[model samples]
Target chain A: MDPTDRETACFEAGVKFGALYHQFAGTPVSAKNADSLETAIEESIENQPGCSAVSVDIHTDKLETTRGYTELTGEYMDVTLRIEYADCIVHAEMEMEDGYPLMRVVDIVEE
Target chain B: MDPTDRETACFEAGVKFGALYHQFAGTPVSAKNADSLETAIEESIENQPGCSAVSVDIHTDKLETTRGYTELTGEYMDVTLRIEYADCIVHAEMEMEDGYPLMRVVDIVEE
Candidate 1:
């Protein structure tokens, strides 16, 4: 596939992974604690069997304000994580807009 | 040699092209007329020899405000331009922030 396809695949993988992870945690993924979520993902991939390495490439901050409250959340994290199969570059994005938890798998690349 | 290098080279080429084009026109390139600019570029390349095709892939708008003046500008134009010397996919981006003409060449891909 092309770069765009790879990016889309990575994004879908991230979204699926995020959903499964949230279900496993049994709590709403916290946008306020993006770092924690990032760390957890890093740790999981790093400690997993046959994994090579896991690292965060980019973590972006985004803020949205409503009439009564303002949310300081992350726009996206362009992360390059390695696994046993291959090096999977993924972008895990989280956004809280209009009091809604918007989690999206923005990108993935296998190199 | 790599994607990043190609992107950088393309960006530099676009910047040089923009500068030279501006000099030739004896006017500052207007962000307000992005479509016009895009059309001009398309016409230039399409009319040129060795150019298989020329198309504007993306155009974007942006707004910037100063202490007294609210200036509307363009954020960026992610354009994919084709030339005769191979199909050079170029992104011509422009942004005006803080009352400065922040013209940038963001990416280039030769496929």
Candidate 2:
């Protein structure tokens, strides 16, 4: 069967989530620059097609700053994305679920 | 509607590709560090579930070395991944398609 608009929307959402998490995972981040990193991540992913909005929160307190900077990972941040494809709008999120980063679709609205 | 095993395999393949592209897209790279980054990327993505193997090649000749290091991008790398889910096996690739990075499913085999 051909993929529906809703399915494509979900796939696009998954793409964004995977991209957001992996692309910045090993970045060198620290407490002092967490703010800038968060903003940069949001702006960067927003450049993708179908992505209407992106929000990133990096937990500075959880950052491993022992070396002044540590590699960023899913454990230190949470992300939400709003993706619109055709008439289907999808909401997706990446959060730590059971001590692991999980990307999931939260909702879908058709317009 | 529920997604089939093949659809889920495709979705998982997309996740790995997106994660691979985004996670390392903006890292500082040069001729010397390209090898290490490529290795790191392959090992990192292979750690994910369903990813059987990953191969990455960094085109060091394209490295913009005026600053001694340039941010990595899809333009600088070509990646191929093998993903195994349930009884389905997926082969996927990310390469330059008309000056833009294109992620695609190359083939699928079931056993």
Candidate No. with top lDDT: 2
As a whole number from 0 to 100, the lDDT of residue B106 in candidate 2 is: 74
The runs of at least 3 residues in candidate 1 whose Cα sits more than 4 Å from the true structure, single-residue gaps closed, are: A1-111, B1-12, B19-21, B24-42, B45-88
- i-RMS, each model, one decimal: 15.9, 3.7
**Per-model CA lDDT versus the true structure:** 0.38, 0.83
TM-score of model number 1: 0.25
Task: Enumerate residue pairs that collide in model 1.
Answer: A10-A108, A11-A105, A11-A107, B50-B84
Q: Could you report the DockQ of all the candidates, in the order they appear?
A: 0.01, 0.30
> Candidate 1 vs. truth: CA RMSD?
17.1
What DockQ would you assign to candidate 2? 0.30
Question: What are the chain B TM-scores of all models?
Answer: 0.36, 0.98
Q: Residue-wise lDDT of candidate 2 within A1-111, one digit each (tens)?
A: 335566566667767778888777788999888999999999998998899999999999888777899999999999999889899887877899999988767777889
- The true-versus-predicted C-alpha distance at residue B34 of model 2, in Å, is 5.9
Docking class of 1: incorrect
Q: Ten consecutive residues with minimal summed lDDT in candidate 1 chain A?
A: A19-28
Which tens-of-lDDT digit does each residue in B1-111 have in candidate 2?
A: 345566566667778888888778889999988999999999999998999999999999988999999999999889999889899887888899999987767777779
